[model samples]
Target: MAAQFRRMAMWTWPGAVYNEHPQRMVERLQEGHVDIVIPYICGQRDGHTCWTAEEYDERLRAIIEEAHRADMKVHACFDEVNAYRAMPVYDLRQVRKDGSIGSVLCHANPAVVDYVLDKLRWTLAEFDCDGINLEDGYIFNQNTIYDPAHTTGELFQVVPVCYCSYCQEHAPIEKPEWAQWKQEQLTALIAAESALVRKQKPGAPFSVAARMPYDRSFYAPHKQEVPYFDGWEVCQSRDALMADWAAWLRRGHIDFACPMSYFHSRRLVELETQECRHLSPTAANDIWIGLGLGECTAEYRQGNGDDPATENAKDPALRNDGAAIEALLLDQLRVGQEKVVFFSYEHLLDEHLSVMARYR
Candidate 1:
């Protein structure tokens, strides 16, 4: 037998219910010794108008209750960056450098923060979830994003956000420093949310779906080889993304940080972990590497733009083979990683489950 991880978990969205019942999904995961189930419950899901926690209450409760019966901890995930609706939060989304609004919400604005936390507060009170997770938990825009709205000729006009009226009207400094101001906004948001979670459920783990830096040296292989990824100068690099999650970890605002460093290349994975260890010795242990079953290559959108949920995923052609998954899973274990979480539950194949069960 090989070494096992401290906890095995998955990130999933509301669409998972279509393929199998939440109850059965939890049971199968339990069979593979997966102890944590992190499902996205808040924010507007891509295709459906899953407006609030109340709308998802039944399925969310089903996932929680069944996971509990399997003795698994359920962590409800919230997307900090993406919220699309006619609501106030959507109205306050990050403004592109071109003056157009981006897809992600703006946490820098107090009103936006109030709306997000209000929903989170309700979720904590209602669900029997053991913890909370924030995906894209930052306020940032980058040139690397390939927005379907923008043609290649006009790509130079966007930075993806923070030029909204509040930022323009409330200039903290005549010329606020970019990185410092962004860092402050992100850290403050995490502190407030973490405090809220702990206050509601003392000792619950507060985790972030962390990001990795893009560099020619370490990340080249992932970019050059991966199917749909663009070779941006910097996509979701921590510093530019304004998500100083390591600072949050040092301040005890979060229980752990899981960087989404999904790659089939062992070299990229090693470099990714090396970067995490280099972030801060004090915070390194809390960094859980995020692996993925497959990278999403395409998504189906209707004329009105609602993404209907499906089991096979928005697309599944590029999913790693069973052998590749087995090797990647073992490679991380051998390299002294204490924790590893998969990118999705929807993409989990039978072969993937077997690999997890072997080590678990």
Candidate 2:
């Protein structure tokens, strides 16, 4: 019983066999009243090394054609650092604090940026996607660097990372400094990717599925806080990543920002939507508050990397329920006047589809 959204979208992840059949996937999406479909094409590592660029383009075209036939637009969704094995091997790993290594492709390396841009360029030119959505993989990880011993003999540690001589050759130093450099590099990357998308297809929508900032009050009276760095500052400071999404949105570097506000509480959803609106009033309309659904409660517990002991003790009624989901969607539309996108078709059930039909 809420007003309809001007644009409705759905996101899909890799290994989601629910999307094995593109036509069927498109049909289900259409049935759910989705106006756009963003399917994750890049696997664990970059798509280029996973498969030939030509093959990637061919497969995307097949899905694009299927969506087009159903009157739905397709946006090529890629994970920025979701690859387990990136091509051009040298550009794949991030340096950890203890001089160990991380699996994500390092942002400090221009070669990695070039690889991502090249893929975007070729995909835009060869495929008929309506837009591009780059999902930032700057999620939380361990910070191992230790600060000097305090007078009290307390050891302060940090997640000094991406210290590979190569990263230093490009950005210099680690941890906090790496954060600023990471923002700079990622900003440039998004800017460059946007430019490429426009060059290939002028006026094409370019977006990012960015990380949502931590909501200080989500757990409230209980006094438990979501991991701040992992969800917010850590990716920026430790991973040398940028989730200061509003700045990018305001600058027009990105057309739309679908922040992953994966909270179970509808109240928290409103809070984040308000925060994003305040952060970029000029582009608030461009912010689509991403809502989680279908196995979301389980996914939150199992996937988010936070201490399960703490999070598991919370309410079980937080996510993926038909009535609760309807309330969340209505809250976005009514309170935020914002658009919404569900996580994936894999977790979505018939009841979820039934709720979406009301908006249609």
Candidate 3:
């Protein structure tokens, strides 16, 4: 039989901060029966900029040491989204249309790859972390590209469309264009980075948190375009997520899978459990589901509310409440997936603590 499933904390950078000292959070986590704490590290802060590599390293070291002392493993996130803030090139690749360049940076570019690798190296070398979590590492929004003709550094809030001269010049021969190619490149990068991390920290774990569903195109209007990876999906519905999840298990790219199931009703929870059962036969023994403890608001709970106007809004699927939290955990337990991770650390409140205690 497989080892008993363990609880993991999916913490955000700001959440980590609000948890105040790492030691205190670790104590609470232990009391809550958590086995791992995966803290988020955003690349930017307050919509302006992200910390330098050195600053990130210092923070990571503190968290890692504190958690380890409490017998809890620390899983550090190398968030690429926030990293974009510090990037000299705001776009991931350049797109060419109507004789103009776009803003997305080209992942094929050696410089971009090197820059990401350097950040990973810094994280590993500077901290005694137990694992590395790569979040939003693959999804590419359409507006990241910029026009090459304009060299001035003007901050534009709109999602950019890359139209750099280089993108235009190489448009015809570029094998992967914008979104599709970036996804493949990111997967390759993760495989390589995972190897690098393992080599340095032989016993450390490496995991990737991705959106669920095999086909997210159906929700395009909702901006839920699925990345082009063999494993992983982030979808709005559990049934939709399972359809793709079954495929991912057969492909075997994922070591473990965690679907963002933040629902409040027992009926939906039962549906999620049934979906997990269908996918389990194909899923690896280590595969587990994830839950969201943070991002819950009173308005969301009442069913007549406005969306939280914060960074959490970036992924509305994460918005959940205490009842939703209970339903998600109960479903996972009912489905026999002993291991579950919370969506974030920042939004966790006093009431949330009481709910987690029942599980312990």
- Which of candidates 1 and 3 is the stronger one according to lDDT? 1
Among these predictions, the greatest TM-score belongs to 1
Runs off by more than 4 Å, candidate 2 = 17-19, 43-59, 138-158, 174-178, 214-241, 298-306, 311-316
lDDT (CA) for every model shown? 0.67, 0.63, 0.50
Scanning candidate 2 in windows of ten residues, the lowest lDDT window is 145-154
Error of 3 at 315 (Å): 17
In model 3, the Cα lDDT at residue 29 comes to 71
lDDT of candidate 3 over 1-360, digit per residue (tens):
223345646555553643367677777777666777787654343342355545654665677787888787877766643335457555554443443433334554556667667768877886677777766433332332111111112221223223445444543343444444444444556566667776787767666554433343333443322111111132221221112333333444335555544433344334444555565673324445555554442223322112123232235443555666765666666666666677667666666666676664
Give me candidate 3's TM-score against the actual structure.
Answer: 0.67
Q: Which candidate gets the maximum lDDT versus the true structure?
A: 1
Evaluate residue 218 in candidate 1 and report its C-alpha lDDT on the 0 to 100 scale: 48
lDDT of 1 at 139: 45
Ranking by TM-score: 1, 2, 3
* TM-score for predicted model 2 compared with the true structure: 0.81
What is candidate 2's lDDT per residue for 97-186, written digit by digit as tens? 677776566765677777777766766776678888886564323342211100111222445556766666776464456556666766
